[model samples]
Target: MASTDDNGVAGYDILRAPGASGGTFTQVGTSTTTSFSDTGLTPSTTYRYQVRARDAAGNTSPVSNTAELTTQPGPSSGTCTTVPTVQTQWGTGYVIQPLTITNTGTSTITGWTATFTLPAGHTLSGSWNGTATVSGQTVTIRNVSHNGTLAPGASTTSVGFQATRPNGNTALPSGYTCA
Candidate 1:
């Protein structure tokens, strides 16, 4: 931001507003130079920015024209992976907890789905943190509203399920795939 002040500009107040249509402006930073770097911003979001100049006498100039930008999207589902770990087992049933879903991509992921195959004679009994559906021996789990949207290299352990298997059968689920 540049301003021509008869009293000589002392500094510039950097203001920021969120959204494409613009919102209330707030003082985000002060800069003696012409630029500022805004950090810790959410991925795939829109933000508006403006600047105001302050002179040595403490007089404030009008804000500059709004500048809008939208950040790039985060990692996609193609870079995600899922792993299901057996937590406990009894004679007739077992549990899989902390089914970790990790984003290994370079950006943020909007959502994720995991698919795996349960062995024969096994049935899913319950699940949490994700929606689970069984089609024959194949189980599909999708992230719920809150657990979706992962940043790069981030992981969520909230997905898991409980299942019943044949007595004395120690087989675990296989073919864990994420997208």
Candidate 2:
């Protein structure tokens, strides 16, 4: 929360693992403040979280203590779907496709995620408009502060990324599921 030049933390990075074990940890997001609430989590499921601090100059500290979260059980209040559109393509690397997320539920939704499997030889590098992270071949895209909320009735938002692809395989990612 405090920002200073002397051993000061400029931001924080939070990571999560499904349930308490077995699943690997993945970077969920980076926040300029101290407190963060991870979004796009399953209802009535357990999650493990760890955070690290980053300085103004981009130096990151070691992982902090781990915490667990168990969301309350309920019929999830919202529905969403994502369609990946090719934004650009080139040799070896292509600008990450923009994923369009549409809100189909009746109520207003606060946050969402677009999960997909990276194609063979494609690797995620960075993104804009949300947090983009890859674990193995699975890519998880989560909402940042500004673009999280969506009104009902086909409200749509998008996130884009940068990745490398096979020279001939400039195709976009497939099998995207919104949550």
Candidate 3:
């Protein structure tokens, strides 16, 4: 079953064997919906299953009425679609800055990178989880290792260095944009 709220409502599991009462169940993974397939059951074996629903607030409803079926021995395969969305935040510091990257996508996101151009007379002091390169008067942050799978809607934050010269322009940094 699916929760469809995008707030970490994935799927539920059957907690008991056939005809068993007072079984416990749990939620697995983070998504709106989940499906289960009984592919390896012996052809003549009977199986019973139930479903339930959950929300981001950790609330669960009564278990679904049980259903029974026999599995047909065969090969089975299927796929689910997941996408990735991202959000960024620029911090409060004027020169020493922090950027928080959040993945709002339906799928995992990896190897993410962001670039910004420095204003005249401004230079980057240092960076984390990435490399900062400068050419002419522009600075580029590259090779960022967002090594973790931003699972559907996870987030990571990084910080970098910038220096303002005595005659630095008061205008904001260049080439920095957020969606």
Best by lDDT: 1
In terms of TM-score, how similar is model 1 to the real structure? 0.57
lDDT by residue for model 3 over 1-179, one digit each (tens)? 34444565444544334333444433323335566654445654565666676766666657788777766543112112212122222332244445545555566554344555665655555566656677866655543555334565555555455444444345455555322
Residue-level lDDT tens digits of model 2 in 1-179 = 33345767778899999987779989999999888877777888999988988888777878888888899865437888888777777888877556788888988778888898888889987888988878888999888878778888664545888888878886667789988
lDDT of 1 by residue, 1-179 (tens): 23455688888999988999848999999988887889988889999999998888777888989999999865454479998788999989999998999998988887898999999999999999999999999999989999898999999998889999999998889999998
lDDT for model 3, on a 0 to 1 scale? 0.49
TM-score of every candidate:
0.57, 0.56, 0.39
Please tell me which predicted candidate would have the highest TM-score against the true structure. 1
How large is the C-alpha RMSD of every model relative to the true structure? 14.7, 15.5, 18.5
Clashing pairs in 2: none
Instruction: Report model 3's TM-score to 2 decimal places.
Output: 0.39
Judge candidate 1 against the unseen true structure and give its global Cα lDDT, from 0 to 1: 0.89
Write down the RMSD of candidate 2 (Cα, Å).
15.5
Collision count of model 3: 7
Error of 1 at 166 (Å): 0.9
Q: Please report, in order, the local distance difference test score of every candidate based on alpha carbons.
A: 0.89, 0.80, 0.49
Q: Which of the two, 2 or 3, has more lDDT? A: 2
